[model samples]
Target: MRMTTNANRRVTDEQIERARSIDLVQFLQQYEPPGELKRIGQSWTLKSHDSMRISADGRWNWFSQNKGGGDAIGFLQAVHGMSFQDAVRTLAGEDFKTIPTTQAEHKAKPPERAAFALPPKNNGNRRVFAYLHRSRGIAAEIINHCIKNDLLYEDAQHHNAVFVGKDENHNARYAFLRGTLTASHFRQEATGSDKSYGFFLRGSGKTLFVCEAAIDALSIATLRKFDGLDWKKDNYLALGGVTASESKLPAALERTLNTFSFKRVVLCFDNDAAGQTAARRIFTMLRQQFSENLEVQTCVPKVKDFNDQLCVKLQNGKNSPSRGTRESTLSR
Candidate 1:
């Protein structure tokens, strides 16, 4: 077998395979910051990019970016944009001893997770209300409901909108922050937040609608209100984002499907290349996962997203496109 040289050392194919087969979750947990990798049921997902997951068997997939690899070397190449030679050299170093070739040996003690907590609440929600209602075109009634239900609030220091997500026990486990300042476009998940429990609104109906962001979910509710329908009739979940892989499902959507008995799931992603592709892929995944037990569909906005559609309606009044024409749903 031909040998490849790195630095002054000869690299064998066996050594390369050993490096490639290093368990990704273990590698990430060892090198990344505490709480950067979170466990969601059977898989681990990156905290900053919830769409990426690493299975226990050492395979990893970044569904959003449509990239994946079978081991740590692939993770480094795909995520850190490291070249193949560098990834192999880094992983095969003497400083990082290789583990035994067993599934049990792949498990490493994860770092202690940071405590999850919501940001301090502002004395008033004036800025969040103004930003959502005035800037994002969300209805006042919808904002009030979110606040009253403890699903949304304003952070004291920055006055950013804090959208909360709760677990089955109804305890807040996740939060997403969005800046209220028009000039700022800051957005991020709160420290130690779990993406599996995303910001969502519970409803009595059996239909669950999924979107890319909390604001988009609210905009959909507002649009329903504009159509003379009850805004809270159906469940709405913000995935925080979407992944393009047809084989993988977002952690939030997976958790929601397991927690609730929904007969129908509607994808309301943004009207863009990434969003549309994700919607189509997720639609296929749902069919394969649930088969005839569930009905999967897509509901795309005529513009960029539900928020943009709402803004157009507010600006054009009756002259805006009809609700039927503004959004289209494809059943599968």
Candidate 2:
């Protein structure tokens, strides 16, 4: 079982079963700890049966166990001393070109640094800002494509987070912090990497554009809000994943609401089957809230969402039958 580092590490599942089939004495004494297995991340101590210990041969050490298991990523962090990016690559056992770390770099553990929480300064975590900002840039084309269709943006109130081209400054505007999903659904998505259902429609205002989920709202605004189209300058809203319902939002957010000339609210949820049902329910509820006829129209994506349409544009030649309501179930 004890193999040299230069020796190829051939580990067959069968070999493991063979070892396991052996008696405790045979395993503890004769079985070697084949090619040096380096510990990753923190030490892992475990319980075993029948005096099962590898023949140390000056190379084996039992890792003292811990009650809590580290994250899989964390485990790699301890073993190879890798940074987050590098650790990702090492575990994958392949070149992750989206990163710069080589195998050696990944194996090296990151140095400890002081952890501190600074208040909201102008330069709050430039690294995080840069990453998210870049995501916005990559997302811009998709945004523009949406605008070209039929959506619109409210200009005046977008000062907090400015818009490009129309506003001149690169800023993020308002933050609509509501979801149709229960607080629990919103919490799960917010904590995870896929923060799609979000809209930061910053602007000064009264009228609003409301949708069922964050993704639909943001896409409607970013892709076409400024398309000089029919976007009625209402503050956009995404009711998380649910159509607007009897959900209560913080009064502070509601107090900030303003619209242009107070146009009727547009209930633009997805055009999916669920969206159709939700839109009908929302329209009935909202019509009662205002004296004006609240126009609750549903906007369905030709493909999935605006992003899917953008990808189709990118993949097929832009001039091909790839653009617009031509083949989508949306135009109807």
lDDT of each: 0.77, 0.33
Candidate 2, residues 1-332, lDDT tens digits: the string is 21123113344455334332322222222222432332211211113311111111111122221101112233333333455444333333233212233532343342232232111222222332222124322245434433343122222321112111111132222222211222211111111111122333433444465654444555455444223233334466543344222233212123323222444455565555445555565566555554474443445566645445434544554422334324221221
TM-score of 2: 0.35
Residue-level lDDT tens digits of model 1 in 1-332: 01234444656787697686566666666667888888865557888888676656555656556455456766776677665776787677543555455543545544345688899999999999999988888989899999999999999998999999999988999998888987775776776787789998999988888998899999888777676666677889998766565466888999999999999888998887667877888888899989979988889888888888888878877322254333444212
Q: How well does candidate 2 score on lDDT at residue 272? A: 53
Runs of candidate 1 with Cα error greater than 4 angstroms are 1-111, 318-326, 330-332
Report each candidate's C-alpha RMSD, comma-separated, in the order given: 7.2, 19.6
Worst 10 residues of 2 by lDDT: 50-59
List where candidate 2 sits over 4 angstroms from the true fold.
1-200, 203-207, 225-234, 243-261, 313-332
